[model samples]
Target chain A: MKLTILGCHSATPRINTHPTSQVLEIRNHIFLIDCGEGTQVQLRKNKVKFNRIKHIFISHLHGDHCFGLVGLISTFRLLTREADLHIYAPKGLKEVITMQMKLSDSWTNYKLIFHELTSRESELIFEDDKVEVYTIPLDHRIYTNGFLFKEKENERKLLLGNAEEAKINKAYFRKLKQGFDVINEEGELIKNDTVTKAGSAPKSYAFCSDTAYNESIVPIISNVDVLYHESTFLEKLSHLADKTKHATAKQAATIAKKANVKKLVLGHFSTRYDNITEFINEASEVFENVEVAEAGKTFEF
Target chain B: MKLTILGCHSATPRINTHPTSQVLEIRNHIFLIDCGEGTQVQLRKNKVKFNRIKHIFISHLHGDHCFGLVGLISTFRLLTREADLHIYAPKGLKEVITMQMKLSDSWTNYKLIFHELTSRESELIFEDDKVEVYTIPLDHRIYTNGFLFKEKENERKLLLGNAEEAKINKAYFRKLKQGFDVINEEGELIKNDTVTKAGSAPKSYAFCSDTAYNESIVPIISNVDVLYHESTFLEKLSHLADKTKHATAKQAATIAKKANVKKLVLGHFSTRYDNITEFINEASEVFENVEVAEAGKTFEF
Candidate 1:
C-alpha cells in the first residue's frame, strides 16, 4: 500500500502549504481523503491520475476538509468522466454539494453517489474481497469520522516441492493452500503444515484527524501497521489544543503509543509554526517511530 | 484605479494556471470579482490585505467563477473578521452558500449580505459617493452578469494660485471645488473655470467574461478607460467558441473597437494553447491597444 500526502497543514490553505487532503492506494483502489480547497490542483501537481479516484472519504464538514468536493465533482464533469463516483462523508455533505450543482445547473453526466455516515460506533462501512474499511468515530466539535483501511489476510502459500514429494494430487493443492489437510493419491491423510507455509502478514492503516486526544479510538486502531493522527498543536500549545478540540503533537504520540501502531505519521500542523521539525521532535519523545506528513511526500508500506 | 489579475485562465484551475478571479481597486475600495477556486491563495500571494475585500462580485454560478467563495468566507470567520461582507451575484448564490454553512455549522460571526441579481437588462448594483457599480448582462450557459465599475466624476481640482488671484474667499473654495461659480469678497462673480480646472477624467473599468460574441454590452461599456473581456479561443477555434458560449480573441477585439474603449485587456484563455502571445497578436489585428491578462500581473489605469 502507498500513501501520498497531498496536503497536511491545518485551518487554511497557503501558497506552499495546503489544508488537509491525502491519497491512499490500497488493493488497486485510490481513495481520496479530506479534500480541502485546491485539492484538485494538488492532485495534478502530484501526478495522480484523476480517474483513479473513485471513492472519496471526508472526515468532517469544515471548509478545510470538504470544500474541494464541489470543484472536483465539477472538474470531473468538465473532463467528461463517465465512471461512477462514490463519496463517504458525514451527513449533510450531499445537501451541500447537490445544492451547488443545482444552483450552477451543471449536473454530472455520470453517477454521483453519496454514502452518508452518521453512526457513532465503529461499524464496517466498506468491504471487498481483499480489503475492509471501518469507521473510527472521533470526538470533535461537530460530527466527524476517521476511516480505517485493513487488507484482508492472504491465502497461505503452498510449498511446491514438499507438496510434490508428499504425492499430493493436483486437485488437493488448492486445499493445501487453504491450510486444510487433504487426502493424497494413496488415500492417506496429508498434513497441511508439511506442504504449506504461512503467508505474509496483513497490513492496515488508520486515519484520524480534527479530533481531541481521546482514548476511545485506541482500541479500534490498535496494532495497525501505520496510524496517521492529527498533531495540530505543539506541546507548548497543549492548552490551546484542549480548548480548540485539537490534539497536540505529544498527545498524538501518546495515542500512537497506546494504540501500539508500528509507525506513527503526524500531520495537520497549525500554520502558526514556520518550521515543522519540532512536531516530529516532540512526537518522537513518546512514539519512537514518528514522522511528519509533508505536502507532496509519499510513504510506502 | 488599479486592477490585479489574480487568475485569468479559462476552464479548470491547474498548478500554475488559475481560473477566473480578479481584484479591482477603485475609489479606495478593493472589490473581488469572480472568485474561482484557490483565489484566497492567489490573493495572499498578491499581497492583498484580507480586510480590504469588503465586497465580492460573482459573475455566475459556474464552479470556475465562484467555488472559492465558501472557503474564503470560512477563513474570514476563522480569522475573526468583524466587518460585514457584501456579495453581489446571480440569484441562488445565497441559498448555496447558506446551505453549506448550515451543514458545516460554521456560520460567520460577521454579517454576510447577499444581493442577488436576476434582471437581464443592465442595472446599478452598487454605488457610493465616490464610485458606482453597474451590472452588464452577458450571454452565457447560465445566468451571468459582468460588472462595470465607474469612478464617479471627481470634484474640480483647486487651482490655488488662480483662485487666490481671483480673490475667492476661503468659504467659497468649497463651492469652487464643486464646479460652481461663487461670489467673491468684493461681491463680484468669480467664474468656476478661473478658480479650478477639471479633475482628472473619471476612470471606468468594465469586466466582461464567460460571454459569447454579443454586441449588446458595447453601449453599456462604451468609452470606459479599460475593458477586460474574455477571449477563450483564437480565430481557428471560433467554432468551438460559439458552441461553448465563449468569445474568440478576434471577437473580443472587435467588441473593444466598437465600444471605443481606451485599453482592451484580454483574458480567460483556454488551456489548449501553450503560446499566449498569439492571442495578443490576433486581438491587436482589430484593436491597436490590446494586452493579455497574465496571472499575478497588475494593470494601472
Candidate 2:
C-alpha cells in the first residue's frame, strides 16, 4: 500500500501551503480523501493520474475539506470521461456540487454516483473480495466521518514439495490452498497444515481529521497498521485546539498510544506554525513510531 | 491603470498554467475579474492585498471562469474580514454560492452582495466618482459579459504657473481645476484652457474573455486605452475555436483593429501550443500594437 499527501496544511490555501487532500492507493484502488481547494493542481504536481481516482471520500462539509469537489467534477467532464465516479461524503455535499453544475449548465456525460453518509455509528460502507471499508464516526463541529480501509485475509499458500510427498493429487491443490484437508488417490486423508503454510498478515489503515480528541474512535481504529490523525495545533495551544474542535499533537499522540497503532502519521497542520518538526517532537514524547505528512510526500508500507 | 495577470490560460488549471483570473487596479480600487480555481493562491503569489479587493466581476458561470469564488469567500471569513464584498456575475451564480456557504454554515462576518446580471445589452454595472464599469455583451456558449473599466474624466489639471500668471486667486484655483473660467482678484476673467489642459485623457481598459469573435462588443469597448481579449486558439485551430465559442488570436486582433483600441492584450491561451509567441505573431498580422498576457506579468497603461 502507498499513500501520497497532496496537501496537508489546514484552514486556507496559501502561496506555498495547500489545504487537506491525499491519495491512498491500496489493492489496485486509488481513493482520494478530503479534496481541498487547488487539489486538481496538486494532483497534477504529484503526477497522479486523474482518471485513476474512481472513488473520493470526504470527511466533512467544511470548505477546507471539500471545496475542490466541483472543480474536479468539471474537469472530468472536460476530459470526456466515461467511467462512473463515486463520491462518499456528508449528506449536504451532493446539493452543493449539483447546484454548481446546474448553474454552469455542465451536466457530466459520465455517471456521478454520490454515497451520502449520515450514519453516526461505525458501520461497513464498502466491501469487495480483497478489501473492506468502514466508517469511523468522529466528533467535529459538523457531521464528519473518517474511513478505515482493511485488506481481506489472504488464502493460505500451498507447500508444493510437501503436498507431492504426501501423494496429494494435483486436483486437490485448490483445496489445500483453501486450508482444507482432502483424500488423496490412495484414499488417505492428509492434514491441511502439513501441505500448506500460513499466508502473510493483512494490512489496515485509518484516516481521521478535523475532529477533537475523542477516545470513542480509539476502539474503531485499534491496532491498525497505519493511522493518520489530524494535529492542527501544538501542545501549547491545547485550549485553542479544544475550542475549535481540533486535536493537538500531544492529543493525537495520546490517541495513537491508546489505539496501539503500528505507526502514527500526523497531518492537517495549521499554517501558523512554521516549524513542522515541532509536531514530531511533541508526538514522539508519547508515541515512539510517528511520522509527519508533508505535501507531495509518499509513504509505502 | 495597472493590470496584473494572475492567470491567463484556458481550460483546466495545470502545474505551470492557470485558468482565467486577473486583478485590475484603477484609481484606488483593486477589482478581481474572473476568479478561476486556485485564484486565491495566485493572488497571494502576486502579492495582492486581500483587503483591498472589494469587488469581483465574473464573466460567466463556467468552472474555469469562476470556480474559486466560494473558496475565496470562505478564506475571507477565516481572515475575519468586515468589509462588504460585491460580486457581479450571471444570474444563477448567487444560488450556487449561497448553497455552498449554507452547507458549510460559514456565513461571512462581512456582507456579501450579489449583482446578478441578465442583460443582453451593454449596461453600466458599477460607478463611482473616479471610475465607471460597464458590461460589454459578448457571444459565447453561455451568457457572458466583458467588463469596461473607464477612469471617469479626471479633474482638469491645474497649471500652477499659468494660474499664477493669470492672477487667479487661491480660492479660484479649485474652480480652475474644474475647467471653469474664474474671475481673479484683479477683476479679470481667466480662461480655463489657458490654465489647464485635459487630464491624462482618462485612461480606459476593457477585459473581454471566454467569448467568440463577436463584433457586438466593439462599440462598447471602442477606443479603450488597453483591451485584453481572449485568444484561446491559434490560426490553425480556428475551426475548434468556433466550435468551442472561443476566439483565435487572429480573430481577436481583428476585433481590436476594428475597435481602434490603443493596445491589444491577448490572453486565455490554450495549453496545446508550447509557443505563446505564435499568438503575438498571428495577432500582429492584423493589428500592430498587440501584447501577450503571461501569468504574473503586469501591464501598466
Candidates 1 onward: DockQ, in order: 0.83, 0.83
Query: In model 1, what is the error at residue A5, expressed in angstroms?
Result: 0.6
lDDT string for model 1 (A1-301, tens) is 9999999998888898899999999989999999999999999999999998999999999888988889999999989999999999998989888888988889999999999998999998888888899999999888999999999987799999998888998988887877899988888998888989998888999999989999999999999999999999998998899998999999999999999999999999999998999998998989999999999999999
lDDT of each: 0.93, 0.93
Cα-based TM-score, every candidate = 0.97, 0.98
Against the hidden true structure, what lDDT does model 2 obtain?
A: 0.93
lDDT of 1: 0.93
**Model 1, TM vs. native:** 0.97
> Tens-digit lDDT track for model 1 on B1-301?
9999999998799988999999999989999999999999999999999988999999999999999999999999999999999999998999988988888788899999999999999999999999999999999999999999999889999999988888878988888888899988788998899878999989999999989999999999999999999999999999999998999999999999999999999999898888999999999999989999999999999
TM-score for chain A as predicted in candidate 1: 0.95
Cα lDDT tens digits, model 2, B132-237, are: 9999888888899999999988899998999898888899878877789998879988789999987878999999998999988889889999999999999898
Spell out the clash pairs found in candidate 1: none
